[model samples]
Target: MVNRVPNEWLLYCRAGFEPDLTAEITARAHELDEPGQVVAAESNSGFVRWQSRDSRPANGIHRGLPLMSLVFARQSLVAFEPLSLSRDDRISPVVELIKESGWNFESIWHETPDTNEGKSLSRLAKSLSRPLESALKRGGGLRRKAGGRRLHLFWLAGDAVQIGMSFPGNRSEHPGGVLRLRHPADAPSRSTLKLEEAWHTFVPKEAWESRLHEGMQAVDLGAAPGGWTYQLVRRGMFVYAIDNGPMAPGLMATGQVEHLREDGFVWEPPYRLDWLVCDIVDKPMRVIDMVERWLIKRWCREAIFNLKLPMKKRWEEVQRCLTRLEVTLKAEGIEADIACRHLYHDREEVTVHVRLKGER
Candidate 1:
């Protein structure tokens, strides 16, 4: 029920990675023969817009370049309007514009930038959502059905706003492309949230009970303090927590984990394992080699690892490592679905989730 602007895209990404995202978007636009320019205000400002150079009408970016195929962005939308609301009552103008467009929305999300000032808008956005929905529903511009699309209100401020539309399954389910996860009080470390977020992203909840069952074996590389190990043992899986440092008392008391004082790089899995995890502060290439070995040699069925990035040429490093992994997987005739993300909780690193791809 929503309309897309011709050759315009709205991409949401992590803060401080705006330049990398801009480059990624421009490259894709060129490759698709739809060259465009990116309009961004500053670095680490959260979201950016892609302006198309082509005057001819087209389907925008959802035709072939799906959001999942793009690594730099967290979520993307096709924009239809950009307005300047320099008044106090913003809902009137926003509603009027949406009504004039002659489109309906299944839902509406009031998104803000991932900056300090942006975070302050949360209260205002919450207060505005109900009134906005009421206005849209009264004007017959809102429909809570699968056939309708979602409306995105990128509220940069009271005066600047962008109206975009995203189809279901084509955009992030998490608001503002940020996963709002709660930290467990008993969790060994903050790193636990990273693995928890990974589970929600790559694996389905129903499958977890079966796939990560009791007595299943797992290896936690560099698992000092046992953050990732905490998640596995909580699920009743037998974990080999490999680290030279001490672990949390609560984690060890569970009796589901065995602390191994050894180097993660030099040690090898005793046998095939269900899960192999790594979260070490090291070079990206070395970690890639270890993951490649485990997967190539069939030492584990699945893995979740972290790759530390150098500040300079960060995206280039991601692409280089990605290419290496893809090439090896293809040569080995192994079917796998690998997903990576610059998580909201992560800083200067990305979390990867890899699993065997079931044949059709």
Candidate 2:
């Protein structure tokens, strides 16, 4: 008989979003036939720990949960039980565990939750990182190679650490799954980072030249102050900025943007556009409806938009909107790729990217 044991998984999310991530993971686990219970889900903790119902091996949970399919989770990994260490020698046990596991890692990430308490542990994590790496190297457990698994040392306290591993392509590239970006000096608003991060998250870097190249015609709905429009302009795309509100003088001076004082909801493009971006603050369903209409009409080949979610049942609302959009597109025989994420720069909204297949 196969030996079965409970499995634990760690998921990181934005503080105050722990409930949503827990609900989502529970629902997903049920669907995958791997029912589990939350072992640790403190409100505003910025992290959650879940364990299976003692029915499968440790690897079962990892096989079932794909990090990309989860909207709220910033990062997910197979985590071991927390370890209590002496203040003097925090490195030896961790090195011993990796050596015993017989796993090689491409790199090691010393992480902490995205919270005030977590921030306080940063120095502790940093101080131990080099010694830990050196110890792991001495133990022959650390090897830097492309496509290798990444070992994570998540610090919960001065004496508590959780050891975990995340697959290369299946996990966020950044530590704690937060992509820290520097704001450009000339950008009109910090909101510009949302669109910029969306591109980095959804679109492959190699395809940027072809997909976001020069001379492309684009449209920015709700383009006031031109945060989103600035990204397109910087990429050398000619933009039709649609809004009744005044735009930034610097963006207009670039001669790459044509300001159209019109309502984004009702305006129609004169011809097909290469890209369509919307950052309108409205009901999530209403925004989704407009985006659906644009795609069905073939008004744009690709789109990046935001869905401002409701306070209650945010994840459920997102599911309903995405499911309906996908089903409607399928009924109309439109092939497209859709991805959504609760971006680092986003507060009460999620960024979505959709690209129609076979459309240049």
Candidate 3:
């Protein structure tokens, strides 16, 4: 029978995205599903939280809900799925564990030719079995009927996988469609370890590179070693590399980058900037404050930054921050497009991209 799971983990990061931050990711896996037994989670870092209904105790410790609560309480489920594991060298143990589980294997969704070879079908099955069982156990006619179909695998990133018991109405891997990188030059290779791979999955290379206009100005806060700045410079945009430390020679040598050796919070741009980018290791509140200053003050025309989340109350805090920011911006008569995504390349942090309306 087929089972369905979450497409993304929405990794709960504590003030930054870290590849090793598996606990928050695990919590998110359980957080995504309704009636699933967490069969087994990868024991090492706890990134992979697998759930099934086949009499196995869901592995690892769930954060808030007790076992009884899941069984007895009317928990409002928002589509839970197990996290997927990815690394430079090792095969994800979750892949193996899912095979060990009794759930039948199925196809994958949104998988690309380059990555399709590495896809693990059985592993995804175990992670989704519990959720499927729940739908059947609940006697939801459509959901149960859907469960009878073959399973489908859709990898969201290293932190999450989307398991579908039925085929998607449309076969597109990116159901939301593609987000091309604003600049192709910004596409860092697999060797570029500093940037996460998932970012590329979310932001396509052709789109982004083509979108970058020649004279756009941008600022990179805390741009030491300049991994992100490298993307900007390659776009042929003038960038203010704001940080106290030295940027990589390659990024600096581009001449498109201007070193700004001042505190990100205290520094002011000489004029309005096209974009404000920050990847500082600080409290989410601080990042919010930085974004607020830019938005409320009209310091930049657009922005892309990261908000490092704290454990335990990540969703609440993100809501609070986003709500407050939206209110603040509205109060200031600013209109902008804002989005938060757990990019494939991001660890512990969520990326924010905001563009003010009516800006050319």
Best model number under lDDT: 2
Candidate 1 accuracy as TM-score:
0.92
Which residue runs of candidate 1 sit more than 4 Å off their true CA positions?
1-7, 55-59, 146-148, 358-360
Cα deviation of 139, candidate 2, in Å: 2.3
Superposed Cα deviation of residue 132, candidate 3 (Å)? 20
CA lDDT scores, all candidates in order:
0.81, 0.87, 0.51
Candidate 2 stretches greater than 4 Å from native: 1-6, 55-58, 144-147
lDDT of 3 by residue, 233-305 (tens): 7667899988999877767666898998989987888998877878889998888988889888888976777
Ranking by TM-score: 2, 1, 3
Which number leads on TM-score? 2
Which is better, 1 or 3, measured by TM-score? Answer: 1
**TM-score of each model, in listed order:** 0.92, 0.95, 0.54
Task: Report the candidate with higher TM-score, 2 versus 3.
Answer: 2
lDDT of 2 by residue, 1-360 (tens): 111222578889999888888888888888888867888989999998887665444467676777877889899898776778888889887887777666768788999999999999999998888888888878888876636888899999998888888886788999899999989999999988889999999889999999999999999999999999999999999999999999999999999999999999989999999999999999988999999999999999999999998887888988888998999999999999998889899998888899999975
Question: Which residue pairs collide in model 2, if any?
Answer: none
Better of 1 and 2 by TM-score: 2
Which lDDT tens digits does candidate 1 get at residues 125-231?
78889999999999877977737588888888767778877886677788888788999999989999998887877787788876778889999999999999999
* Clash statistics: count for each candidate: 1, 0, 32
Superposition TM-score, candidate 3 onto the true structure: 0.54
